[model samples]
Target chain A: MPTADHATGSYPRTARTTPTRAAQRASWDRERVHGILDDGYLCHLGFVRDGAAVVLPTLYARVGERLYVHGSTGSYPLRTASGAPQGLPVCVTVTHVDGLVLARSAFHHSVNYRSVVVHGTARQVTDPAEKAAALDAIVDQAIPGRSADCRPANGKEAAATAVLAIELTEVSAKFRTGGPNDEPEDRELPHWSGVLPVSVSTGAPVAAPDLAAGVALPSYLTAQRSTNA
Target chain B: MPTADHATGSYPRTARTTPTRAAQRASWDRERVHGILDDGYLCHLGFVRDGAAVVLPTLYARVGERLYVHGSTGSYPLRTASGAPQGLPVCVTVTHVDGLVLARSAFHHSVNYRSVVVHGTARQVTDPAEKAAALDAIVDQAIPGRSADCRPANGKEAAATAVLAIELTEVSAKFRTGGPNDEPEDRELPHWSGVLPVSVSTGAPVAAPDLAAGVALPSYLTAQRSTNA
Candidate 1:
């Protein structure tokens, strides 16, 4: 039985979004998908080069149903994406490993993780307005409400950057939580079994050595310390 | 000038491993590469399927100059790699977000991260001895010294699993540390800029509801909590 929420959500199931293995963990819920994407700013962007595969770690931001990836115009993949007329086929994946599951038997050992995978054709954003917004969103993705604090990009900087936009048409989130699913027979083994909770921790922020005298820590940043912790 | 460690090393640099942008951050030192790989077990494995790029988050372990990826025999990539006589062309990437950098200007905003990218061909481990070792190494990757604590995999369980090994010959580690590199002119902007230190944190372990009465929390796990912190 699939654990997908009642299947009547905004994102309709596609052939590729369906999972053959762990079907129950796959979800097509749009709100659930958005929550997963919003939780993290970093993602692994994968694309094919020549006849092999290449995956790069990059920053990303989600706006409505679309995702914007930050890159330099001089980079190989982004430069190619800017010139491709029909857009480049790509896959964006975000994952958070919540805990380490230690089961009685090694076969049942697993990690508690929530991951969102987005697959679609990505094209460079040429419009000045959208590109500006995308760049601001990328900054805010790392530090919420930060775009308004910094000086807007100059023309030269904007021209040197590339932003690729991909929609959330083909997406799915798979997650595993709680304890390990050890086999019934293995439960009696003399093994210490449990879940070791793991999470992203933020330490005290260190101000820039050259920060101006009048500047102070932003309230949004202090708020994030608790929210993200 | 490229910041690559003086040419001579255990692993030679290839065309793909030489980074174009931010060449100063790329390093070919074998010890540095191993340090980054040993820090995390999760990796994004990329491969081409049906002419489109597919990237999946998977568990991986590093043994000397080899990397073993955990998967089931029924999984798509593992199944294909097993049948291909010449092995499957793939890229395995691991990343750690050390800090979030906030710059005075939007263009200079960045992340402090350490990442290792390996481009090579992966083949299934058919030899039983190597397969067993790979499986144990994977368990230890996530939780050091964990393989010995759990019940070993039975023959039936081992038959259903597949371990893909890829060498570290064409590998490079890219890292960014310290604060953001705001442009000289933007340094005086009235913005509080700095780096928010980010890291993986472990919480108190929660014992399994069905754990045997005699079993107790393992010392190795407690040791990991402080080491990983």
Candidate 2:
């Protein structure tokens, strides 16, 4: 797959992309931004509705610099997409808390995380080929190589879903790692401080109660268990 | 501790609180809402700024129906809080992805999750006593029994932080569980179908490289390892 930024290899910094705090942790590297977005399957999507800000948790997939997200046609955000000119202004963010940073002082405690924020207008995908490809990408993103094994959405099901494509125009990724930054004066304080590493891990696969008699668990899922370590 | 609504024990539903899709997954039960909020440490806070929507990922604490979030005074959303009347109109959401449901058909694949959305006006918390307690709640929410073990924030540190408290007025919890609901005809397709359970797991704690000679890991930290199972 082509990278998010094919030419310059880095995204231009915008006013909104700049980090105000811990500016050292922010990056506008296109590859880094794509990496963070690809690592997580879920994102919090924020958009304006009736002049009110609403944030919804949803699944998304990125193909190059374009992000695809879908929902039922009956959903309010999707319903409003057709009426909005050009597209609906939206902010999408993906975050993974890597660890809990413990410090001698409560004020200094923080979490180690990697996050990507994208600001762009999302327009409802209308082209049938693009919609179908986006849907497949979305499914395969959740489980690698799963799309080929499953049946693609039929015409009726395709009409029931609304997919939005947001081009990544302004994007930034921020990350923090390593140990706590405690004050020098508090160095003598007898407090246990460290990092408790955290991750989203997968457990054993639970077959459906009505799974066919002889079908075996796919190697893709068994492969995930090893990588999960 | 007083519950959010001790008498009614439920949040009133409005058009915004209602789910347009998968309506059966929506619940207005206050306890359910509180449970979802308490289980997560991070939240996406959405608020309008300069006629645009801004969503930020931040740490939050839930004390009864009141959600407390804090950030640097210089932060954009924190700065906007003081200007909005009564408080800043905000939407706070917490979500936990429990499992990935792989279906025989790509369109039927989904995720099991529990999410809570609260819409309300957030007022700047100024009372020193309330602010102190909320800070403790926020820290302890990350690790139970942690606040008493660490040094409390000093005056200088406290002054730099801005806390906003939002009353949980319009709240709703949505959940999806069970195996994938594949079409009856696709049930016999030669494809793997089931759920891959996912969870936030903690690895062994890594003590700071510059830790004091004899400072031991607290029992609370040790206890977490067992519960993390």
Candidate 3:
């Protein structure tokens, strides 16, 4: 299991849990957490602006122990954090809904999902090497063989992208799996009840017509077709 | 097309569009907006708490002209809005990623996604009739025939649910669809480039073992198995 170490530095309120206890609701073993993160390609990032909360959907990737998020350099929140003292206080979350739990009663009806929330101040990654690695992680996160098959960014292209790294040290994962739990009285209710299983698998890859004729599908690319991970 | 009537109330800044937009950035049509909302099941709702921002995932349904969300009566955020002067200001968003855009150059890479963001204050639905409709909408949103296949909630069950309704008067939709767009110069780079299409569909429904032996599958339930919507 990979753990995020926080000895580098301290962030504001990073260690203090929110009063709602939403930040510390449940503890997750490392494999469960990483598996969820690896299966997800996008995340919903939340932050405060002018005293009101705003949620934005963005692409993200997880490396050894940190998550990398990037966006257009012109986006407000990312640009604002570039020079702010506290950086940008954010609650980053990634979720994967695995199945739908259909309980006998409405109150117990829920979805089986695995979610991870990280509370921290995301800092801009300035080092060129780290920035390159982050970009590769993002590509690989979307498709396993993609990063190596594509051309690396040139100087001008690299300068246009803004990358931020959030260490996943103070993170927590929550999951709800398995079938529904119905009250004993409702068991005799005539309605049918059970779990609706959900999963995602890749179909046969469609190669671009413009592709140079002889370039065959690589092993890494073919591996994704059978992967449910 | 269902157009959002701004005449009912002034649109908030987030949902309001400026008049001087260029042609390329002006794709705010009603059908495009509703299509995005209808295609998604989960929404990310953002709200402010003691000057910090919080985002939570919740189930959502779109009624004829309104968006509905419901949760337990004990949920703090939903309960706190019952007495707030302007109701709780919220940012609700739904997104669906269609494919991965693998640009030849890293900087141009992006995901093909359809997203809708609603900016408004959500009011608690107090009318019993309205609440019942909202609950039905939610069930139908999850599984199209679910509401009719099961017995309707009784008086006690209905009373236990708390529903909130927000008119879709101020909404904005943004989308990035289609294949990867790589720079002209990078087109000749040795790379595998094209869309790896993504989709979600229902799998075989696992019938409860307790179901009466030899009971035929309901037609409505059977229809859902092949539906992508």
- Top candidate on lDDT is 1
Against the true structure, candidate 1 has what lDDT?
0.87
The reply for model 1, stretches above 4 Å from the true place, is A1-7, A224-229, B1-7, B224-229
Q: What lDDT tens digits, residue by residue, belong to model 2 across residues B1-229?
A: 4444657878888888998889899998888888888887889999876676778889999998799997778788777786676778889889988889999988889999999998888888889899999999998887888999999999999998889999888889999999999899988888889999888777789999888889999987886441211
Clashes of 2: 0
Candidate 1 DockQ category? high
Kindly give the number of clashing pairs for every candidate. Answer: 0, 0, 0
Quote the lDDT for B200 in model 2.
79
Candidate 2 ranges beyond 4 A from true positions: A1-6, A225-229, B1-5, B225-229
lDDT per residue for candidate 1 within B76-160, as digits (tens), equals 8888999999999999999998888999988888899999999989999999999999999999999889999899889998998
Task: Give lDDT: candidate 1, residue B226.
Answer: 29
How accurately is candidate 1 docked according to DockQ? 0.81
Ranking by lDDT: 1, 2, 3
Per-residue lDDT of model 3, residues B176-211, tens digit only: 766667777777767766666565555666765665
State the lDDT at A140 in candidate 3: 82
lDDT minimum window of 10 residues, candidate 3 chain A: A8-17
